[model samples]
Structure formats: structure tokens, C-alpha cells
Target: MEKSAVYHRPSDNFAYSINKTTLQIRLRTKKADVQNVKLLFGDPYIWENNEWQIEEMPMTLSGSDDVFDYWQVYVSPAFKRLRYGFKLQSDADTLIYTEKGFYETAPLDTDFYFCIPYLHQNEVFDAPDWVKNTVWYQIFPERFANGDSSLDPKDTKPWGSEKPAVNNFFGGDFAGIIQHLDYLVDLGINGIYFTPVFKAYSNHKYDTIDYMEIDPQFGDKETLKRLIAECHSRGIKVMLDAVFNHSGYYFPPFQDVLEKGEQSPYKEWFHPHSFPLTGGERPNYDAFGFVESMPKLNTANPEVKDYLLTVGKYWIEEFNIDGWRLDVANEIDHQFWREFRQEVRSIKSDLYILGEIWHDSMAWLRGDQFDGVMNYPFTTNIKNLLAKQSITGQEFIENMSKVYHNYPKNVFEVTFNLVGSHDTPRILTECEDDEQRTKLIYTILLTFMGTPCLYYGDEIGMSGGADPGCRECMKWNEEDQNLDMKQHIQRLINLRTNERLLANDGEIEFLLPDSPNGIFGYRKYTEDKSIVVLVNSTDTEKSYSFTEPLSDIKDIYSGKTYTGSSVTLEGYGFAILNY
Candidate 1:
């Protein structure tokens, strides 16, 4: 409360630094109920198809105070702008605790997130507020659109085929995005969040091979310059997805360890004893994650921290990019993120940092590391409830309301909410292909609190089953889009950008139904106006008597007037009203 007693550096002057890619932490807080402060680092692994993949972080609290604080935990080889945060331990709240020990979410959604320090404050971090009051579109760099036919991969597979497979690249490149700037600007998207564009072997580029260079496939520096210049002229900001949690085996250091045993000078860059004694093979590393192709970089190494930090800052200076979306953000060392936020602000005070967080990230949102986090808790929760057909109207209201109260008020307004991203099935498909239900999903995303992001093709009625299936090429066809999907999305974006009441101020409440049926309702208002969104999750149309607060608004979508005591909604129906 009252912003809490915190000492923070001037946003303009702060920067995170690493010297040896090694670090030590000493606890500074006076509290003694100290269990162990777990030092965790890795990418925020995307949870899909019910699989969990994590990049392991080596812990070195090792009782050394000389290198770090008595409680100062250290990990290294950190990049200047890597995403990281802390997880603290106290006997008081046994439920859940991250470095700062705060959580906010609802039963409406079970997904949660850890808070980080890179959160841009409300002008507090000296970073100019993000071009707030704008719209964002998330583009999977490889699939959105291939503007240059020459750039299309010669070995690409057909989308959705079982043989060649969905994992194959579709040749979407930065130049492709540059070519479509006109299309996107016309659609009213002011910000673009491209999935990881760093050098990697795969189409997704999560296995970062080099942080400094944009993958040659994406385009060279010249292409990026033109794209950045054109986008800036058009008022569009490009945010690249930066993956810092691990490096591919092809990464120089990883390969060095493979080629030369203890003689390798870079041996300390990874988990100790991670390399095998024979053939200098790393049969495995301590990094207990999904696979070995992606070797977890020892962020605890001071040298590693310093190297990444320098690279992150370089991008801002080299290219006038707007910001970054940290991939697998949860797994990176906390020290790395703290230092990164400090440094990046110094480089470009206006940059925005978004983290890939699945859980309640309120702790990370506390005037620190990230300006906002991808709201998976809200996204997946809504998807699962709708898919299972068990979501209640009251449950919906209560769940979202909890989100409203979960994060710090100042930064909460800017969090990103979306119905689907590249990693999940399209919202329409996720909800069992029901057009009306997907419309309800639309209401939840565009009208709810925070900035809403629409996946590249979802607005045009793109459909798929799951992860690889959800990520498909953009449909240039205006007719194939289901139910005027593009137009509907345009309306939603217009509402978010144009309506002050809907943008920030809103009241979320559950209309407790007589039975346990699923029906959720929420309202947004300001001094001069109000907007209401009501959805029915059950098969049958739901009805309820009108009440004082809700009876006042008119349905903007249908121009229906409501008065008196009871109001009724058709089955699988939703109403958006304004008054």
C-alpha cells in the first residue's frame, strides 16, 4: 500500500551489469524464518498439450558473501537486458511466493506467473509510457506472411499435413512484415509483437544460437533498418521476442566444451560437471529440462550475464526497436533481469518489456522488471472453461475480478490479454468451433482490462486444433474469414482504443445465478458512460431479473433496451451494451 517503501534507481540511470558469468547471493532482509531462497532460472516454458519444459538454473548461494550480499544471490554470464526476478521465502504465506511474495488471480483461471523487476513503472522508470492507447498484434515471424517470394524456404511443407509436418518453416521474414506494414496499419494495430527473431536453427527460433544477429533468414541489418524506419513513420512499434534462457548446442561456447574437455576456457560457462569425461561429450548437463539440444546457459556466470547484457543494449542502440517480449522468461536468473531492466532503460528510456508469463505475475509487476506479462492465466482459463462447458457466469466475473485486484494498480492497466497466440489453438477452434461462443471469447479479450493482443490470423477467422495447428499462415482471402471475423476484430480494437471507460476503468462482478450454471457478467464505466458484457456458458438461454446497476445500460451490439427487474440472454449468447 502507498507504493510500499522501496528504493529504486532513476529509470534513466539504472543498468544491470555482469563480469564473470558467475554470481553469489547473500540475503539482505532481516527476517529469520528463512527456509532456503531457491535460485531458479530458465525460459518461461510454454505449457501446451499438457507438457512441461523448463531450462534449469544452477544455484550458487553457496554461503559466499564476498561476491554477493549475505542474501545476495548471484548467477552470471548475464546479458544486460535479460528478464529475471526473485522468489522469496517466508513462513507467513505458505500458499505461493516469488522473490517479492505477492499473488493475484481467481478460480476462473488457475494459470499463474512470477513477478520480475523489469516492469516499466508509470513514468517511474523514466521510460516513456508505452505508446499507450494503442493496439497490438502478435505475429509468428515465420508464418504471418512471406512478402518476398525469394525469401520463402525452398523446403517448406504444406500447412497441417501430418507427414512434412507443422514444425517446418513457412518463410515469414522481417521483410515480409515490412511489406505488410500498410495492411497492419490500416487494420489499426500500432504495436507488433513478433515471436523470437534471434538466430536459431528452427522456425520458432527459441533455441537461441546468437543473440546479437537477427537470423539471416529473417533478413540482414539493412532490411531491419528499412522496416524499423517505415514502421516508425507509420506510427507502428516493433517488439522482438528475445529468448535468453538457453543456447543451442551449436552456440560457440557449448560447442567449445564439446570439442575440448577441461582445457576449454569456456568450460565454466555451463553447469559444472555437465560435460562427459569421454570424447569430451556432454552426454548431459545438470539442466534437467525437456531436451539437450537447447543447453541451459549458466546465467550464474558473471561473464554470461555481462555478454547478454551488452547484446541486449546493443540492439536498442543499433536499431530503434521499440521493446522486447522475453521468451521462457521465468527460467532466467533473477539477477540477470534486474540488471537488464536497469541497463535497457539507460539505453532507450521508452522501451517496453513484455514477459511470457503463465501464472499470476503481479509480483513481477510491482514497479520493477516487466512492464506487462502475457496473461496465460486469463487466456487458458477462459479456453478450458469454455472447452469443458463448465464455466459459470458468476465464476467468470469472480475470476476476472480477482485479476483486477491481483496486480499493482499503476501497471495493471497495460497487461496484454489475448484469446489465442501462436502456441495455442485459435479461440474459435478451442471453443468447439461455435461461432457465437467465439464471439463471446472476443468480448472477454477486447473489452476486459489491459491491452488486448489478437493473434495474426485469428481476426480473419483462422482455425486450428492445438499448438502447431494453431500457428498457420495468414489468409489473404477476405471471403474465407468466418462470419466477417476481420470486421468484428476491427470493431473490438476500435472499442479498446477509442473508449476511455473501456480502456482502463471497469467494474467486474458475478451475477450469482440461482443454480450452478455458467453465466458471467462484467461492466466498464467512467463518469460519463458505461459498457456491459454478459455471456451465457450453458446450452439453454439464461434469464435473470434486471437490477439497479445493470438496468441502466443499453445493448450497443443490438440496440436493445433493458429496464425493470429481470433480463434474459439466449443460449450461447452475449450482449455488449453501452449507455
Candidate 2:
């Protein structure tokens, strides 16, 4: 009926803008019989020229794959969604199974619609008047706090085996987080972003073991319901991390396939590969689809989708959460997400769905996949700019402008900006204990457009070098630490949360001084307010002067009064002004 799906990719769904420059194309299928597949395109519909005809751009895969089967095709780093597909020479004809063929993702899917009709209010892409005003705090549940020691992992636990390393087990349970919601409230965080609480094997819980049950070590579902209720009472909403990309090899159904082979009833739930290769002959299959401990699940399996949707809906229907922070998001099927986002809306129309994509939230922000993504590039750019010492203040502003221009208004308005996350060293350590510079980074994170995120212990000056190491327990004691760090953080956060002009809307720029190498300076303000941040990145003190009148803000810390643009800042100093 549709020319036998002349392309093996969802080419029809491929839509992008040249302003972003790059794009991506994704294809997923379990059939291992197809070989020597190559994608060819006639031409991209560049400029609706009243006709579709042009010489297409040609490209090839970076590596070789001769009939290799992938467990999943969650697109990684392929920036733009390209219009291309597989060309496999089948027996009678070289069949082209299109990605978003009419048989698969119908064009009627208005979720994939363009700008005007695709704001996705139901998916929280359409930010309400309330969302723009709230701040969020992300906590990996098991590492946050240990409120109930009684709930600690038992020897040879029922759900899964226990490991002894800090990551293996920390005994952090629901009661622990329940006990600390107030601490978050005190810190002025209006929302909580937690890692999964679902039953799983590893401590991180990325690989789900039991969909219906909560890990005993993490407390039962009742505890979760209570925590949600309590958080609501405190005016704080909860956003649970969603990690459905893959399941642990030991996950029940998958284990059934492992133990019973093709005879297993649930065997259809996964992409079959060389199984149970005992005798240690290197049992074949990409773990995490590419890593062995994390075998990818088949979200395309009707049963898998039905079961997972129920799990997702349960969280919203039961606990009334605000949204979801999808883990390893780019690794999911686009068709599946279109439905997933739709199903989530059936329960609650305005639930936020932020993907954990490092590259571009704009990739999926077309309104079909996710509302937002972790602004990794945003933070990483500044860090690289600082470390390389190659970028100037103006360069930083241009990069940010590029980011903002790529996404729709709402996404750019509510992105999550952070200095450090659970995966990296504390910003304090990255700054090498330069309290003044650390405070400047902190200042920029909040004063910028996105919703600022504070890693659990970063505010108190907790430092770690890398992964696992970055996840240290919270330290409450303030004695002997840099009092300046604590006070400075408090001031910045207060400004972000309480200042009317500083919260969401504002003009931002990095003001370069005459001595270009001397400082990293920026200014942010709306019609109602204005603040300037001048950072002396170097260590040795260097004095400098401002050229114009500066009277918009009363320096909260220095207790200084000024009404002239010509002012000066001390070395390593940052400022916040309201003008």
C-alpha cells in the first residue's frame, strides 16, 4: 500500500533546522538476517520549494557491522534526526523497512507536530505559570541518607545479592529521605528529583529486577506514598528518575530466558542472542546493549510496553509525583517514546519528562520524546572553557545563545543548570578550593535562565574527584569549613528563589573588561532588576575599574551604596546587582 516502506528508517519523522547545523537518524530492528545494509537518501526537503527534488548528502556509519544485532537503538550522540534507512538486498527485492513508516508511527501522531500545535502541554513542555518559579534538587535515594537502619540490606537479600563497596550498599532507605525533606525545604529547594525506588539488583537501580515491587532495602510502597504526601504538605513536589532503557541480566523475565533458553515463555521480551554460554566461553551479548551486566530489554514487545506503562502510571496515580527524569534517555526507541509520552498524559496531562541526554535536549524536544534533558554540554562547556583557558567572556555568551536558540521557548526557559553532579567532582574541588571563584560559578548557575540544580553536598563544600567518589554522604557540620562558601551559596540561592526579577526572565551577558585576560564577568537582569557578576579567574589580586554608572543593586554582603557605572571589583570577586 505504501510502496513497501521504501526506507528502513523513520525518515518521515526526521525534522530539524539548519540553525542547529547537525542532525541524526536512528533505526531499530531485531532481525539478524538483514546484512550489508546501507542508507541512501535522495534529498532533504530543504526550503519548502513547492517540490521535493535535489541531490542528497551522502554519509556512512563510522564502523563496520556485518549482521551484528543490537538489543536496543536508543540513539547516542547522533545530533539531528536524519531522513534515511537501511538497504538490505532481500531474496526477491532489496526491502526498505522505514523507521516511521505509516504502518509504525502514523503521520496523524500530532505529538510529533511542528511548533504551533506541538507545545505538549500534557507533557510539561508547556510550562505553567507555577513551574518557572520553582527550584529542584536531585538526590540518588540510596546515597542521600539512612533514616532506618532496620531496612538495611540483609545477608543474601531476597531481591538480589549484596555487595560491600560504598556503591554496593549504603543502607540508605525511604525513611532516610522522608526525614530530610524538611532539610531540602530549608535549603529553599521547592522540588525533589530522586533516583529510582523500584526493586532492582544493583544499588544504583538502573537495571530493574521487579517492576511491581519496591526494593525491601528501599522500603515498601506505603513509605513512598507517605513521603510524597509529606513533601506535598511542605509545598515540595517529587520527580522520580525513570530508568527503563534496559534491565539487569538477572531481571526475572530475562533470567527466565537465560535459564530456560528458547523454551522460556518470556523469551520474546528480549532480543535473542547466544544465551547461557556457560563454561565461560564469553557468553555473547552487549551488556547495557554495549556493556554485559545490563542486557537491553525489548520495549517494542507489546507485553513489555503494557507492563512498563503500568509501572510508570502507578507512580503518578499512587504518589502524585510532579514528573520523571528519564535515565539514559537517548537510548530508547522514538516510536515507543511517542506512545510513552502519550500514555503518561492519559494519567496527568502536565507531567514533566526530562531526559538524561548529555548532548542536546533539542533532539527530542520537538515535542515527541522529552520535555528537557540534563544540560551536560552547558555545564561542560564552561568547565572546558575555564580549564583550557582558551575562551573569552564573549565566547561563553555566544555558546549559551546557541543553546537557547536551538530549543523552543519553554524548554530554554526551564532547563537544569548545574556545576557538579553525582558523576563528577564537586565544583569546589574543580575550582581547586578557590572559594571566590567557586562562588562565581555558583552565581552563574543560578542567575542564568535554567532551573539551577545543587548536588547534595556541594553547598556545604563536599569534594570528590570522580564517579562513585563524587557520591559521598552529606556532611552537616559547618565548623572549620569555609564560612564564606556557606554564606555565599545561601545568598545566591536566595536571590534565585526570592528575587522577582532574577527568577526566570532576564537578559544575560558576559561583560569583557579592557584587560581581556583579567576576568570572567557577566550581568543578568529583567526590566525590574539587574545584577553584574565580575570574576577574577586568576589568583593574584588585580585591581580594575568600571566605566559607567552602577546603581541598580545594593550589595547585600559588602553593605555598600553606589550610584555610578564607574566602579571597581577586588580580584577573584563576583557581584550581583539589581538595577
Candidate 3:
């Protein structure tokens, strides 16, 4: 046994409450190093005749990746408290793992075990149940479509005619999105996550001038209400971006500060360091990354907190929006989010709260704050192996394992997983225009755990580099679209929505190919059915043979049947084998 590789924490991903009565415990060990694992658990105060009352149960091999095998068990303690430890065994060695450390035999003293003092229902991270079944379609509202030219901005250009810039608008509005409701319905998407749609100075709408109103370029409040109603009519959920971290330079409060200097009533609303506010090279106030055009708000102020919380609750109370994708949520204070979650969910208990965090966000996902953060780590790993080829297939699996283990199982299930968004290059462009590699990346993304998001135009092979280039208007012309890529994406979306095993909380295991050059595989399984997805990233024919002959397998992707153990795939090909 690799003692150094063994690890467990008291209360986190290692141990957590799945619900009010159900507690889940997990352990991580070096892959294939331990032959079996058993869990020892009991209520901390349960004792008789000076001896602790304990119970031992065998742990199941839950899943494995390149470097670690995860063991898990679910327990419901009679007293709603737990003190637990693990009993690990190998072919040649046996060891007891407890809170104190590893030992030759099980510790008789219960003090040496890990502890969960009590199970609190409110502490369990509960995201929206609908998110588990959702396939998100991310829309950059300004580029998605143009329905009412009458509502177009003064300088709006013809759709798909000009290159996208930071300041230019293509007249996309709620009316446009309203016209395309059937289009999204036909694409098999249940959720639509729009980039910032509040009143803002920029075309992207990230710099919010007002959180309470829809951008004039997008439409009026009633127009947005109609759009939301239409989306709901078609069984689609709408998630709007919330830019509470900062306000645009044109925002009324910031303008007042600039006009009246320190004497302004709204001076306390922002983080202005000096009396006379300046915004040339460096603003006197704290802003989003030194950009003077956007000023960060002082969320610590009671007034600011109330105003932001009202904004958070207003949409749910008014339009009945399904979720809010917070912008730069990591920069804000955690207390504000806790209050925000409480306030928003008070109106709609199951309302989804998503954050725009790019790194580890364990602090913000404790059920009192955001439900989940963007799964940027997954995106980074996927891009490295499939896009840049900077890492081998094995390296990708190891990195993915780290990501999987970084958060609690509940948090991992609702994470916003995506390959492309407004902040990144299109997926096809990331693959350097190679359709086959792009397909493989999508196969991995759509089939993997968590809620997957598809950026508009990615399914049709629209190619561009970052930011302004990636935000180009949607190419709706049949002559300009990649029909094959679109169809493949549609199929993947259908599989993700219909397959029970592909739920956010399914048992998944990564498989290693005999030759680990450019092949990767994983299986999503339940008690009823199992699926093995294989991707060959190399530019040559690849064949994989099982250790023993296998029967009763069907390829879901290509609709082919196989009865033998061996399978051959073309260069950059992918197959979903169902058994």
C-alpha cells in the first residue's frame, strides 16, 4: 500500500451529507494498490459499558482514473452524527486509516477516527434538480439573431456582414431570440444561458449601467418577459448573466461620484480610494482589472448589498427566470453571495445560482452561496490534450481525475461544463479547423459528467479566435454551415438528454488503451446499462482489443453492431459502445 498516496479530509469531498438523512463518505487511494476497502463508522456518542458502538461495512470501488481509485459508501446514522475511518487491505499488507494516521490494526479508541458532528439539511449543497437533465445553449444575445430592426441601436450593422468589434452591435434582441425558440427546441436544448443582458455601455453588456432593466438594444422589460414566457412555453429554461461585481462608467451612481467627487451620496457605493475620482490611465477607484470604464462596487455596504440582493430576487419574482450566471463572482465578498442565495431561493427555492469563477471555488459552493462555478479546470484539461496536444492522453486523464476529486459529488454534478464561450475561442477553431478532432472533443464533453453548455455556432463549425472574433454573428445560412458537425452535435445532445447513465451523478471510470499515444476512453454506467466511449486523437488508424472476448455490444454513434472483443477506429474517430 502507498501510505503517502492515501488521503481523506474530515468534511469535504471525502465526507459530506447528500441529504438530511443520507451521509456519503469517500476515500481515495493509489490506483489498483489496495485489493479491498471497508468503512468503519458509528455515531460518536453511541456507547455501551464503556465501549464504543461501531459498525463496519465494505466499500465499493466507485470509480477510477489514471492515478486514483475512489471508494465510496452511503450511511444513515441513527443519531445524525458520525465518527468514521477506513480499513484497507492489499494482497500482501493490511492497514487501518484513521484521523490520527495509518496503523497496523484498527484503533480501539474512537478518538482516532474522523468525525462528522452532525448532519444539517441546509448545509447540503443542493442545486436545481432540473440542471442534471439540462443541455445548455449559451447565447451571446447580440450575435445570436436579429428579429426587430426597429429596436436596433443607432450604429447597429447588418447581421453577419461586418467583423465583430468590442463596440459594434448587430441588432440582436429578445425579439430575435423569441423568433428562434423553435430553432433551439429542435436542437434538443433545454436551457439557454445568455451572456450579460442588462443595460450596459459595451456591445457585450458586461459593463452594467443598470441591473434592473433590459438593455435597450436587447428590448424592453415587457419584451424580455414575453421572451421568457415563450422560452418557458417550449420547456426551455432561461439563465441571464448578473454583472453585480462592477458597474459601467455610464452608470448613474458612478457618474454622480465623478460629478460631485466625495460629496456625492453614492460615494460609499463604490471603492473609490481618493476624494476626486479619476478615470484616465488608472482610476482612483477599484475596478475590474484596472479598466477605468468599469468600476467595482463596494458590496460590503449595506445599501449596495440590499440593492444587489433586490436585483437577484427581482427576476425570479417578475419574469420567473430559472438561473443566474454570475460574472466575476470570485471578486465579490462571500457574505453577499450567501445573502444573495438566501434571498433568491426564498422566492424560488430551486433557482440555479452559477458563478463565473475560473479556479478552485470550494469556498463559494457550500450550498449557502453559489450552487456551482464554471468548470474551467475541465476546459483547460480538454484544451490541452485535444486542442494544443501539449499533454498526452494519460496526462489528460490524470488532470481530469484531480478535477473530479477537487469538489464534493453534489457540487461536481451541477458544474457548468463547456468547451467554448464568449470568453474563449470557438471549439472548432481550438481544433485548428480539424472536424474530426473537434468531434472527439465534443464526444468527451457531452458524454462526461456535469451540465454541458454549447456555445452558439460551435455545433455548426463556426471558426474564430478569441473575444471579438469568437463573438461573431451566428451564421444561419445553409451554404456557410457545416451540416455534418451540426448533425453530430445534435445527436450528442439527444444522447445526453435521453440517457440516464449520462446524468451529472453517474458512476464514471476512465479506461487506458494498450498503446496510450492518442487514445482515451471512459465508461458511464448504471445498474441497468453501460456505455464505453472511445476517442482516437491521432491521425492514423487505431485498434483496441479487450483482454477477453466481449459480446452484446452496439455502437450508439455509428449504429453498428459488434460481438467480438476487438474494435478498429479511423483516425480521429469516436465511438459510443453500449452494452
Which prediction has the highest TM-score against the true structure? Answer: 3
Candidate 2 all-Cα RMSD: 13.7
Model 3: runs farther than 4 Å from truth?
A: 30-33, 48-50, 61-69, 90-92
Per-residue lDDT of candidate 1, residues 69-172 (tens digit):
12333455233112333344446532222334334311111123332233222424222355446578899888876766566566764432332134587677
lDDT of 2 by residue, 343-399 (tens): 887798778877888885555776676766788867876675554346654456545
Off by over 4 Å in 1: 1-128, 157-167, 277-283, 286-288, 506-515, 549-552
The CA lDDT at 238 in model 1 is: 81
Model 3, span 335-368: residue lDDT tens:
9998898889889988999999999888887778
TM-scores, in order shown?
0.74, 0.73, 0.96
Locate the minimum summed-lDDT window of 10 residues in model 2. Answer: 68-77
- How would the candidate models be sorted by lDDT, starting from the highest? 3, 1, 2
- Clashes (backbone N, CA, C under 3 Å), per candidate, total 85, 26, 0
TM-score of 3: 0.96
lDDT agreement with native, every candidate: 0.63, 0.62, 0.87
